[model samples]
Target chain A: MRRDRSIIKNEKSLRTYITPPADLYETPDAYILYIDLPGVTKENLNIKVVDNSLIVQGKFELSLPKDSDTMFSELAKGEYRREFVLAGDVDRNKIDAKLVNGVLILTLGKKEESKEIEIKIE
Target chain B: MTLVRWSPLRDLATEIFDLQREINKMFDRFFRGFEEEEEVRISTWSPRVDISETDDEYIVRAEIPGVSKDDVKVTIRDNVLTISGEKKQEKETKNENFHRIERVYGSFTRSFTLPGAVKVDKVEAKFKDGVLTIKLPKVEEAKTKEIEVKVG
Candidate 1:
């Protein structure tokens, strides 16, 4: 356990079994990443891309009483945070993000020159 | 002769308190209406467990899926069995996106007081496919045995 500035300098990956499955697909033009994120509203979600990295942040409101006795509670009350680094061939300006059914689907289009890669043996 | 004016602070506090109470009531109704409420997240998620008693030993099984074996810790001290663990989040791409997050994370601990005398020195624990099984063998005298009676 090592720390700097009272903050965890190195955070291990935060994996959750409840996270929606992600599907990656690539065509000649672009690549698509689909992730499921239920119980989240668009108003409470934020998506940002900075310096070749994409960040997704959203708070899950349990909306439960603090003192009330709960029969069962499965939905965790906290902000969901996830980040990903972009590849060199990714066209950041053309990236698109959409939230539907509590799932975040991101489409990263490839650069024009990289769309049709060529390999030749001299 | 001076006149004292009433402030709205008290009225505001009362209004806030009433709002809080109303919110609580609404949440109570919503929770009651939940059909498939399974496990609630408190400080940690502790699932219900079942224990079986046999002639040789006591078998305990706990339902804790998505939790790794390395995260679970089991110990017995003075006839008190304590199980504790923390489920660490998994690794993802630098820009991992999630749609629905429902899993519970954090440290969970459960303690059980042994009902019958048993051999603590030989307590064994095995974690397989998300289920933790513990076997506590009963001492020779603590085990129920059949006695033969020879009479005319």
Candidate 2:
């Protein structure tokens, strides 16, 4: 997959949120990040990698009906932002991402120099 | 063999974030009363819901994303409607290195008491795009009736 090289500038000025839940997992060759961004469409998500941190942000647009009444309000509707610090073991060029059903999945491939090599005895 | 309770999500990294959010929520609630609505709005960890009533039906909408259809259940018995289900974690990965866990995962139940008798057979429920919509049709007597007044 082609890498996302266009950096999103001046987006940090907007008010951010800390609610969307995230999970990270690592494999032998890569690390995966899953972010729950419900109600956010693919067009509203922004994924960026700067220096040593990977940032994922999403915006949600939900409007209630004019005649509706909110009996219960729990889920906060706003931007969902999360950042992960890459520890130099990740391959910046090989990173990839996809959003399915409002869940953003980011995979950061491990650097070839960081993978463990099994030694063989003659 | 004896076992020790282990939870990686309970580590210090997540606790600090949770603490910060608590502080922010407190401040929001403190200033919320200044609005025109005198009643304070409370936010919880559960899914948000909206309930509306029309002449023929009462509609309920809930925002519960990322949950599959099989995991959710809706039932009504004795005029008490209940939506209960489990929010399970994503399937196991090769080796998960969790950083933050903000989404709640567990079995949750939200029940609502119907104000008037509804036609149980006519109730219809639909789940789409992680939102659940339930339509409860009101009985004949439960609907409002308009009467004209004679002029003096």
Candidate 3:
């Protein structure tokens, strides 16, 4: 029921961009996002923030032997795309991204003024 | 209108019938080389795989992200190739407040029957970048041969 769009198709490339499964976690200092992108290398992954939206794109290469015929195919090869709208508290400049074991981990730090502050009473 | 009383035995029989139908549907999907999308979120999820056949060998590649190389197991028994593994969740995320969770975790197993005989001793499997590729060399008799005819 989330408002994010799932899949997008490129007209020129004729390649479909699937939305990879993701998990979002909120901590006191940052928001962490995990995206599963199997068979995608770090060089094939792209992440950028435009305005208040964070967009991620990845491509998976399927290498087959010469003169080979595919008998059964269930794995989707091509591209993966997903976009998330940033909240006001999220500091876009403090975002960190890393690829580990084919999973993309993104940490979006919270803004200075948005973090919880403890006040002492005299 | 006639009121019918609920019977426990009848209800049990209907439940068993539904279970049998579900199993049959699962087998049908397996033979068709397809899986339902909604099933990915279940506790036990199967990774997507691609099978290709060359002139000398059969290649199988499976997509299993976030799984360690040591957690995977590949075996060919009775001409059935099976790939089983576990995708463990990160322990650091346990304390964090989760907003949305769509990725699947836990153990998975996928099996496929080989169409031809292969050299089990020469099979090789490699895991890289969360994808496992297995190569099964075909036996001599199973390899395709080219024959030419000479006109008299």
Candidate 4:
């Protein structure tokens, strides 16, 4: 291995994954999670629910012209991972997910037993 | 008062303490996203960016997910390149019960002076997949030139 290649390997070892920013909201019907995942195509994303937690992971490679030379680079291109513990009332089977413009939106529905029941005066 | 002698061990302990605090702060930022705005002069949620130089143009890319195309604006004036945008929250606070509010929503502006003269008219900006790419074509004189030297 060459010297510069070793340096690149060291940099890769320093960071194996990034935790993308996420917005989590709860409504009467469900808990919604919106995560930023730029440069990731829809097919490249992987989402799973296990151990009472919601996990989202995606892999992305930066697309740049072959002739271009990076002068200043702050963005990291690699695997993105985020895990959120699901609430006790959430129904994993009712969860729905969608990808819009590189944003992963996950809706975890609340179980019927968890919703509040309104009472009216007779 | 008598001068106190320096303690190297104590200094090392303090240094490690400071490093631990810094690492904790970075983890907080990574998991929780942006902090609440406290200052009006500058915002803390600026998007990360990358710039590359091609033969004819400079490619500038920024990661700004969840922002609409209409909300973002790009402009070049007085040799300064500016990219500004707002990521608005559409939550109906009255109806929804939020378990958490970690996503940042507010106006953000980033600007920088161009290192070399570029064709303002030829500049192109594209926003897709939550990433903004700006291509600034360099002027003919600003492009790199190479001269070959005869072998000795």
Candidate No. with top lDDT: 3
Residue runs of model 2 more than 4 Å from their true location after superposition: A1-18, A120-122, B1-46, B52-57, B93-97, B119-124, B137-140, B144-151
Q: Candidate order by DockQ, highest to lowest?
A: 3, 4, 2, 1
Report the lDDT of model 3 for residue B108.
90
- What is candidate 1's lDDT per residue for A1-122, written digit by digit as tens? 33562254234343442233455666567777755454456787788887778777765444322343333333344566777777788888898887653456688899987888777989
Worst 10 residues of 1 chain B by lDDT: B33-42
Evaluated on chain A only, model 1 obtains a TM-score of 0.71
Could you give candidate 3's per-residue lDDT for residues A62-122 as a string of tens digits? 8787899887788987799988999899998899998877888999999999998878998
On residues B1-152, what C-alpha lDDT tens digit does candidate 3 reach at each position? 99889999999999999999899788767655323233324446788889888999999999999888899999888787888889988645667588888999989988777878899999999988788999999999989899998999
Q: Candidate 4: DockQ? A: 0.35
lDDT of 4 by residue, B129-149 (tens): 888999999999988899799
Candidate 1 lDDT tens digits, B86-117: 75444343554433345555677776666567
Q: lDDT of model 4 at residue B21?
A: 80
Q: Please report, in order, the local distance difference test score of every candidate based on alpha carbons.
A: 0.63, 0.71, 0.85, 0.80
The C-alpha local distance difference test score for the whole of candidate 4 amounts to 0.80
- In angstroms, give how far residue B69 of model 4 lies from its true place: 0.6
Superposition TM-score, candidate 2 onto the true structure: 0.66
Query: Whole-model lDDT for model 3 versus the true structure?
Result: 0.85
Per-model TM values vs. the true structure: 0.40, 0.66, 0.78, 0.74
TM-score of chain B of each: 0.63, 0.66, 0.70, 0.68
